[model samples]
Target: MKGKISLDLTEGSWTASGGLTFTKASDGRTLRFTGAHGDLAQRSMLVDATVGDEATLPVDLSTYELDMTKITVTMPSVNSPGSVEGRPFSTTLKPDGAAVFSRAFGTSPVPTGSSLATLAGRVDVVPGLG
Candidate 1:
Protein backbone atom coordinates (compact mmCIF):
# COMPACT_ATOMS: atom_id res chain seq x y z
CA MET A 1 0.00 0.00 0.00
CA LYS A 2 1.10 3.57 -0.68
CA GLY A 3 0.58 6.46 1.72
CA LYS A 4 1.76 9.87 2.75
CA ILE A 5 3.22 10.82 6.15
CA SER A 6 3.06 14.33 7.42
CA LEU A 7 4.71 15.68 10.60
CA ASP A 8 4.53 18.94 12.47
CA LEU A 9 7.13 20.27 14.86
CA THR A 10 5.40 21.27 18.06
CA GLU A 11 8.18 23.36 19.63
CA GLY A 12 8.41 25.72 16.70
CA SER A 13 7.10 26.45 13.25
CA TRP A 14 8.61 23.59 11.25
CA THR A 15 6.67 20.90 9.43
CA ALA A 16 7.61 17.79 7.47
CA SER A 17 5.79 16.30 4.51
CA GLY A 18 6.75 12.94 3.04
CA GLY A 19 5.52 9.80 1.35
CA LEU A 20 5.78 6.20 2.43
CA THR A 21 5.23 3.03 0.40
CA PHE A 22 4.59 -0.13 2.34
CA THR A 23 4.69 -3.73 1.24
CA LYS A 24 3.39 -6.69 3.17
CA ALA A 25 5.99 -9.26 4.10
CA SER A 26 6.06 -12.64 5.73
CA ASP A 27 7.62 -11.38 8.95
CA GLY A 28 5.88 -8.02 9.19
CA ARG A 29 5.86 -5.05 6.82
CA THR A 30 8.44 -3.02 4.92
CA LEU A 31 8.20 0.73 4.67
CA ARG A 32 10.06 2.95 2.22
CA PHE A 33 10.04 6.71 2.60
CA THR A 34 10.48 9.18 -0.21
CA GLY A 35 11.99 11.98 1.88
CA ALA A 36 11.28 14.58 4.58
CA HIS A 37 10.41 17.72 2.67
CA GLY A 38 8.99 20.76 4.40
CA ASP A 39 9.39 24.38 5.37
CA LEU A 40 10.84 26.25 8.38
CA ALA A 41 9.87 29.59 9.74
CA GLN A 42 11.13 31.29 12.89
CA ARG A 43 8.44 33.25 14.67
CA SER A 44 9.75 33.76 18.20
CA MET A 45 13.32 34.90 17.98
CA LEU A 46 15.16 37.10 15.54
CA VAL A 47 18.12 35.72 13.68
CA ASP A 48 20.78 37.00 11.36
CA ALA A 49 19.65 34.73 8.56
CA THR A 50 16.58 34.18 6.43
CA VAL A 51 13.98 32.14 8.33
CA GLY A 52 11.42 30.95 5.81
CA ASP A 53 11.59 28.85 2.66
CA GLU A 54 11.42 25.39 1.17
CA ALA A 55 13.58 22.61 2.65
CA THR A 56 14.27 19.10 1.46
CA LEU A 57 16.19 16.45 3.38
CA PRO A 58 16.75 12.76 2.78
CA VAL A 59 15.41 10.22 5.30
CA ASP A 60 16.98 6.82 5.85
CA LEU A 61 14.43 4.05 5.41
CA SER A 62 16.68 1.03 5.28
CA THR A 63 16.36 0.04 8.93
CA TYR A 64 12.67 0.56 9.47
CA GLU A 65 10.22 -2.19 10.41
CA LEU A 66 6.51 -1.79 10.93
CA ASP A 67 5.62 -1.77 14.59
CA MET A 68 2.63 -1.36 16.86
CA THR A 69 3.72 1.98 18.30
CA LYS A 70 7.22 3.02 17.30
CA ILE A 71 9.32 3.20 14.13
CA THR A 72 12.74 4.70 13.60
CA VAL A 73 13.98 6.53 10.50
CA THR A 74 17.20 8.32 9.69
CA MET A 75 18.03 11.66 8.17
CA PRO A 76 21.19 11.59 6.09
CA SER A 77 23.81 14.28 6.47
CA VAL A 78 22.73 17.38 4.59
CA ASN A 79 24.59 20.50 3.43
CA SER A 80 21.97 22.90 2.30
CA PRO A 81 22.51 26.64 2.45
CA GLY A 82 20.49 28.58 5.05
CA SER A 83 19.22 25.40 6.65
CA VAL A 84 20.04 23.13 9.54
CA GLU A 85 22.48 20.54 8.20
CA GLY A 86 24.62 18.10 10.07
CA ARG A 87 25.77 14.52 10.36
CA PRO A 88 23.24 11.79 9.75
CA PHE A 89 20.28 12.02 12.16
CA SER A 90 17.47 9.72 13.14
CA THR A 91 13.94 10.11 14.51
CA THR A 92 11.32 7.78 15.94
CA LEU A 93 7.60 7.89 15.39
CA LYS A 94 4.98 7.00 17.95
CA PRO A 95 1.72 7.44 16.17
CA ASP A 96 -1.69 7.39 17.78
CA GLY A 97 -3.92 6.36 14.96
CA ALA A 98 -3.24 7.88 11.51
CA ALA A 99 -3.60 11.54 12.40
CA VAL A 100 -1.26 12.37 15.28
CA PHE A 101 2.50 11.75 15.30
CA SER A 102 5.16 12.33 17.93
CA ARG A 103 8.90 11.96 17.28
CA ALA A 104 12.35 12.70 18.61
CA PHE A 105 15.79 12.99 16.96
CA GLY A 106 19.06 11.29 17.86
CA THR A 107 20.20 9.89 21.22
CA SER A 108 22.34 12.48 22.85
CA PRO A 109 22.11 15.95 24.39
CA VAL A 110 18.75 16.47 22.70
CA PRO A 111 17.81 18.41 19.60
CA THR A 112 18.03 22.18 19.90
CA GLY A 113 17.68 25.14 17.50
CA SER A 114 15.79 23.43 14.67
CA SER A 115 12.42 21.87 13.95
CA LEU A 116 13.99 18.66 12.74
CA ALA A 117 15.60 18.47 16.12
CA THR A 118 12.36 17.87 18.05
CA LEU A 119 8.94 17.16 16.57
CA ALA A 120 5.45 16.52 17.88
CA GLY A 121 2.09 17.13 16.27
CA ARG A 122 -0.47 15.78 13.80
CA VAL A 123 0.25 13.52 10.82
CA ASP A 124 -2.30 12.94 8.14
CA VAL A 125 -1.89 9.52 6.54
CA VAL A 126 -3.65 9.08 3.26
CA PRO A 127 -3.77 5.54 1.98
CA GLY A 128 -3.87 4.78 -1.71
CA LEU A 129 -6.27 2.18 -2.99
CA GLY A 130 -4.96 -0.74 -4.95
Candidate 2:
Protein backbone atom coordinates (compact mmCIF):
# COMPACT_ATOMS: atom_id res chain seq x y z
CA MET A 1 0.00 0.00 0.00
CA LYS A 2 1.03 3.62 -0.55
CA GLY A 3 0.01 6.91 1.02
CA LYS A 4 0.92 10.49 1.83
CA ILE A 5 1.86 11.47 5.38
CA SER A 6 2.07 14.80 7.15
CA LEU A 7 3.01 15.88 10.66
CA ASP A 8 2.92 19.10 12.64
CA LEU A 9 4.48 19.84 15.97
CA THR A 10 2.31 20.80 18.93
CA GLU A 11 5.00 22.79 20.75
CA GLY A 12 6.43 24.62 17.74
CA SER A 13 5.41 25.70 14.24
CA TRP A 14 7.18 22.91 12.44
CA THR A 15 5.80 20.51 9.84
CA ALA A 16 6.76 17.60 7.62
CA SER A 17 5.32 16.15 4.43
CA GLY A 18 6.08 12.73 3.10
CA GLY A 19 5.01 9.53 1.44
CA LEU A 20 4.41 6.24 3.21
CA THR A 21 4.49 2.62 2.16
CA PHE A 22 3.58 -0.69 3.79
CA THR A 23 5.01 -3.99 2.60
CA LYS A 24 3.94 -7.37 3.85
CA ALA A 25 6.41 -9.87 5.22
CA SER A 26 6.27 -13.37 6.58
CA ASP A 27 7.39 -12.33 10.04
CA GLY A 28 5.17 -9.25 10.27
CA ARG A 29 4.99 -5.95 8.35
CA THR A 30 7.27 -3.14 7.28
CA LEU A 31 6.15 0.48 7.40
CA ARG A 32 8.22 3.18 5.74
CA PHE A 33 8.07 6.94 5.20
CA THR A 34 10.02 9.03 2.74
CA GLY A 35 9.99 12.40 0.85
CA ALA A 36 9.88 14.12 4.23
CA HIS A 37 11.53 17.50 4.77
CA GLY A 38 10.85 20.55 6.89
CA ASP A 39 12.04 21.97 10.22
CA LEU A 40 13.61 18.49 10.41
CA ALA A 41 14.13 15.85 7.85
CA GLN A 42 12.17 12.89 9.13
CA ARG A 43 12.10 9.25 8.12
CA SER A 44 10.90 6.28 10.08
CA MET A 45 10.57 2.52 10.05
CA LEU A 46 8.39 0.17 12.08
CA VAL A 47 9.05 -3.55 12.09
CA ASP A 48 6.47 -5.18 14.27
CA ALA A 49 4.97 -8.64 14.64
CA THR A 50 1.55 -7.37 13.62
CA VAL A 51 0.21 -5.74 10.44
CA GLY A 52 -1.75 -3.16 12.39
CA ASP A 53 -4.90 -5.26 12.47
CA GLU A 54 -6.56 -2.46 14.43
CA ALA A 55 -5.89 0.00 11.62
CA THR A 56 -8.48 0.93 9.00
CA LEU A 57 -7.92 2.62 5.71
CA PRO A 58 -7.80 6.46 5.43
CA VAL A 59 -7.55 6.66 9.23
CA ASP A 60 -6.39 5.02 12.45
CA LEU A 61 -2.75 4.82 13.51
CA SER A 62 -1.76 1.25 12.90
CA THR A 63 -0.59 0.74 16.46
CA TYR A 64 2.63 -1.12 17.11
CA GLU A 65 5.24 -1.76 19.77
CA LEU A 66 8.04 -0.44 17.53
CA ASP A 67 11.67 -1.25 17.97
CA MET A 68 13.07 1.99 19.37
CA THR A 69 16.57 1.38 18.11
CA LYS A 70 15.37 1.67 14.52
CA ILE A 71 14.17 5.28 14.84
CA THR A 72 16.32 8.20 13.66
CA VAL A 73 16.01 11.99 13.25
CA THR A 74 18.21 14.47 11.37
CA MET A 75 18.63 18.02 12.60
CA PRO A 76 20.23 20.96 10.80
CA SER A 77 23.32 22.34 12.49
CA VAL A 78 25.66 25.15 11.61
CA ASN A 79 28.86 23.68 12.92
CA SER A 80 28.05 20.11 12.18
CA PRO A 81 24.92 18.44 10.85
CA GLY A 82 24.16 14.97 12.10
CA SER A 83 21.38 12.76 13.29
CA VAL A 84 20.31 11.92 16.82
CA GLU A 85 19.87 8.20 16.88
CA GLY A 86 17.91 5.85 19.13
CA ARG A 87 15.06 7.31 21.22
CA PRO A 88 11.97 5.75 22.69
CA PHE A 89 8.89 6.51 20.65
CA SER A 90 5.42 5.34 19.62
CA THR A 91 3.04 6.08 16.75
CA THR A 92 -0.70 6.41 16.23
CA LEU A 93 -2.16 6.54 12.73
CA LYS A 94 -5.12 8.92 13.11
CA PRO A 95 -8.59 8.21 11.72
CA ASP A 96 -8.53 11.31 9.52
CA GLY A 97 -5.76 10.00 7.34
CA ALA A 98 -3.13 11.40 9.70
CA ALA A 99 -0.33 9.92 11.77
CA VAL A 100 0.83 10.98 15.21
CA PHE A 101 4.27 10.16 16.50
CA SER A 102 5.29 10.81 20.09
CA ARG A 103 8.82 10.62 21.36
CA ALA A 104 9.72 10.03 25.00
CA PHE A 105 12.94 11.23 26.48
CA GLY A 106 14.70 10.44 29.72
CA THR A 107 14.57 14.14 30.60
CA SER A 108 11.65 16.49 30.06
CA PRO A 109 12.22 19.13 27.40
CA VAL A 110 8.95 20.99 27.76
CA PRO A 111 7.79 22.69 30.90
CA THR A 112 4.32 21.17 30.47
CA GLY A 113 5.93 17.77 31.17
CA SER A 114 4.72 16.24 27.93
CA SER A 115 6.57 14.32 25.30
CA LEU A 116 9.71 15.79 23.77
CA ALA A 117 7.82 15.96 20.50
CA THR A 118 4.27 15.23 19.38
CA LEU A 119 3.66 15.12 15.63
CA ALA A 120 0.21 14.74 14.12
CA GLY A 121 -1.32 15.22 10.66
CA ARG A 122 -3.08 13.50 7.79
CA VAL A 123 -1.85 10.55 5.76
CA ASP A 124 -3.57 9.59 2.52
CA VAL A 125 -3.62 5.83 2.11
CA VAL A 126 -3.98 4.10 -1.26
CA PRO A 127 -4.47 0.40 -1.18
CA GLY A 128 -2.70 -1.92 -3.61
CA LEU A 129 -3.79 -5.37 -4.62
CA GLY A 130 -1.45 -8.25 -3.98
Candidate 3:
Protein backbone atom coordinates (compact mmCIF):
# COMPACT_ATOMS: atom_id res chain seq x y z
CA MET A 1 0.00 0.00 0.00
CA LYS A 2 1.29 3.48 -0.99
CA GLY A 3 -0.44 6.63 0.26
CA LYS A 4 -0.44 9.21 3.02
CA ILE A 5 -2.20 8.22 6.27
CA SER A 6 -3.05 10.72 8.96
CA LEU A 7 -3.66 9.47 12.47
CA ASP A 8 -6.34 12.05 12.89
CA LEU A 9 -9.11 11.92 10.38
CA THR A 10 -10.03 15.46 11.28
CA GLU A 11 -6.78 15.67 9.35
CA GLY A 12 -7.23 12.42 7.33
CA SER A 13 -8.02 8.70 7.82
CA TRP A 14 -6.46 6.06 5.50
CA THR A 15 -5.29 5.46 1.95
CA ALA A 16 -4.90 2.32 -0.22
CA SER A 17 -3.04 2.06 -3.49
CA GLY A 18 -1.11 -0.94 -4.73
CA GLY A 19 -1.27 -3.78 -7.19
CA LEU A 20 -1.26 -7.06 -5.24
CA THR A 21 -0.65 -10.54 -6.58
CA PHE A 22 -0.65 -13.99 -4.96
CA THR A 23 -0.97 -17.66 -5.79
CA LYS A 24 -3.52 -20.01 -4.24
CA ALA A 25 -1.51 -22.90 -2.84
CA SER A 26 -4.14 -25.66 -2.97
CA ASP A 27 -4.57 -25.56 -6.71
CA GLY A 28 -1.43 -23.58 -7.54
CA ARG A 29 -3.47 -20.79 -9.07
CA THR A 30 -1.72 -17.44 -9.24
CA LEU A 31 -3.97 -14.40 -8.98
CA ARG A 32 -3.32 -10.71 -9.61
CA PHE A 33 -5.43 -7.84 -8.30
CA THR A 34 -5.93 -4.09 -8.74
CA GLY A 35 -8.92 -1.93 -7.87
CA ALA A 36 -10.12 1.21 -6.15
CA HIS A 37 -10.09 0.94 -2.36
CA GLY A 38 -13.40 1.97 -0.82
CA ASP A 39 -12.58 3.02 2.72
CA LEU A 40 -14.59 4.80 5.38
CA ALA A 41 -14.06 5.99 8.96
CA GLN A 42 -16.85 7.15 11.17
CA ARG A 43 -16.96 7.88 14.90
CA SER A 44 -18.64 4.79 16.34
CA MET A 45 -18.52 2.84 19.61
CA LEU A 46 -19.89 -0.44 18.28
CA VAL A 47 -18.59 -2.58 15.41
CA ASP A 48 -20.62 -4.90 13.15
CA ALA A 49 -20.00 -7.48 10.35
CA THR A 50 -22.03 -9.86 8.21
CA VAL A 51 -21.79 -12.96 6.11
CA GLY A 52 -22.77 -15.13 2.39
CA ASP A 53 -24.89 -13.79 -0.35
CA GLU A 54 -25.20 -14.95 2.94
CA ALA A 55 -21.36 -14.80 2.93
CA THR A 56 -18.89 -15.03 5.79
CA LEU A 57 -16.74 -12.13 4.67
CA PRO A 58 -13.07 -11.82 5.63
CA VAL A 59 -12.36 -9.05 8.12
CA ASP A 60 -9.44 -7.54 10.04
CA LEU A 61 -10.00 -6.19 13.51
CA SER A 62 -7.01 -6.62 15.80
CA THR A 63 -7.91 -3.26 17.32
CA TYR A 64 -10.69 -0.80 17.09
CA GLU A 65 -10.54 2.57 18.85
CA LEU A 66 -8.09 1.26 21.49
CA ASP A 67 -9.92 -2.06 22.02
CA MET A 68 -8.92 -5.53 20.85
CA THR A 69 -11.52 -7.04 18.54
CA LYS A 70 -9.26 -9.98 17.61
CA ILE A 71 -11.19 -10.43 14.38
CA THR A 72 -8.64 -10.64 11.62
CA VAL A 73 -9.03 -12.00 8.10
CA THR A 74 -7.28 -15.36 7.69
CA MET A 75 -8.04 -16.71 4.21
CA PRO A 76 -8.60 -15.15 0.84
CA SER A 77 -10.16 -17.86 -1.30
CA VAL A 78 -11.30 -19.34 -4.59
CA ASN A 79 -11.79 -23.04 -5.05
CA SER A 80 -13.17 -23.93 -8.45
CA PRO A 81 -12.30 -22.15 -11.66
CA GLY A 82 -13.56 -18.54 -11.65
CA SER A 83 -15.22 -19.03 -8.28
CA VAL A 84 -14.90 -15.34 -7.55
CA GLU A 85 -15.90 -14.22 -10.99
CA GLY A 86 -18.10 -11.13 -10.73
CA ARG A 87 -17.90 -11.31 -6.94
CA PRO A 88 -17.25 -8.30 -4.73
CA PHE A 89 -15.56 -7.93 -1.36
CA SER A 90 -15.92 -5.25 1.31
CA THR A 91 -14.22 -4.41 4.61
CA THR A 92 -14.40 -2.02 7.55
CA LEU A 93 -11.79 -0.47 9.85
CA LYS A 94 -13.12 1.47 12.76
CA PRO A 95 -11.43 4.33 14.59
CA ASP A 96 -7.65 4.24 15.22
CA GLY A 97 -6.51 1.37 12.97
CA ALA A 98 -4.52 0.85 9.81
CA ALA A 99 -5.62 -1.43 6.97
CA VAL A 100 -3.23 -2.17 4.11
CA PHE A 101 -5.63 -3.34 1.46
CA SER A 102 -6.75 -2.03 -1.89
CA ARG A 103 -8.30 -5.00 -3.62
CA ALA A 104 -6.72 -7.44 -1.15
CA PHE A 105 -8.21 -7.65 2.38
CA GLY A 106 -6.03 -10.37 3.84
CA THR A 107 -5.12 -9.58 7.45
CA SER A 108 -2.62 -12.36 8.11
CA PRO A 109 0.34 -10.80 9.96
CA VAL A 110 2.36 -13.61 8.41
CA PRO A 111 3.88 -12.08 5.29
CA THR A 112 3.46 -14.52 2.38
CA GLY A 113 5.19 -15.56 -0.85
CA SER A 114 8.72 -16.96 -1.48
CA SER A 115 10.62 -15.01 1.18
CA LEU A 116 8.31 -16.29 3.90
CA ALA A 117 8.44 -19.80 2.49
CA THR A 118 12.25 -19.65 2.72
CA LEU A 119 12.18 -18.55 6.36
CA ALA A 120 9.83 -21.37 7.41
CA GLY A 121 10.54 -24.52 5.44
CA ARG A 122 7.55 -25.83 3.44
CA VAL A 123 5.22 -23.41 5.21
CA ASP A 124 3.44 -22.41 2.03
CA VAL A 125 1.32 -25.59 1.90
CA VAL A 126 0.67 -26.74 5.41
CA PRO A 127 0.24 -30.50 5.73
CA GLY A 128 -3.17 -31.14 7.28
CA LEU A 129 -4.57 -27.70 6.46
CA GLY A 130 -4.23 -28.41 2.77
Rank the models by lDDT, top first.
2, 1, 3
Kindly list the per-residue Cα lDDT of model 3 for residues 1-130, writing each as its tens digit. Answer: 2222222222223333444445545644433333323232532212122221122233333222222132121222354211111112223343222232222233432332211111100101111233
- How far off is residue 98 in model 1, in Å? 11
TM-score of each: 0.23, 0.22, 0.23
Candidate 3, superposed: residue stretches over 4 Å from native = 1-7, 10-14, 36-130
Instruction: Candidate 2: give the clashing pairs.
Output: 60-93, 60-94, 60-95, 61-92, 61-93, 97-123, 98-121, 98-122
- Report RMSD for candidate 3: 19.7
Q: After superposition, how far is residue 125 of candidate 1 from its true place, in Å?
A: 27
When superposed on Cα atoms, how far off is each prediction in RMSD?
18.5, 14.9, 19.7
Candidate 3 — worst ten consecutive residues by lDDT sum? 114-123
TM-score of 1: 0.23
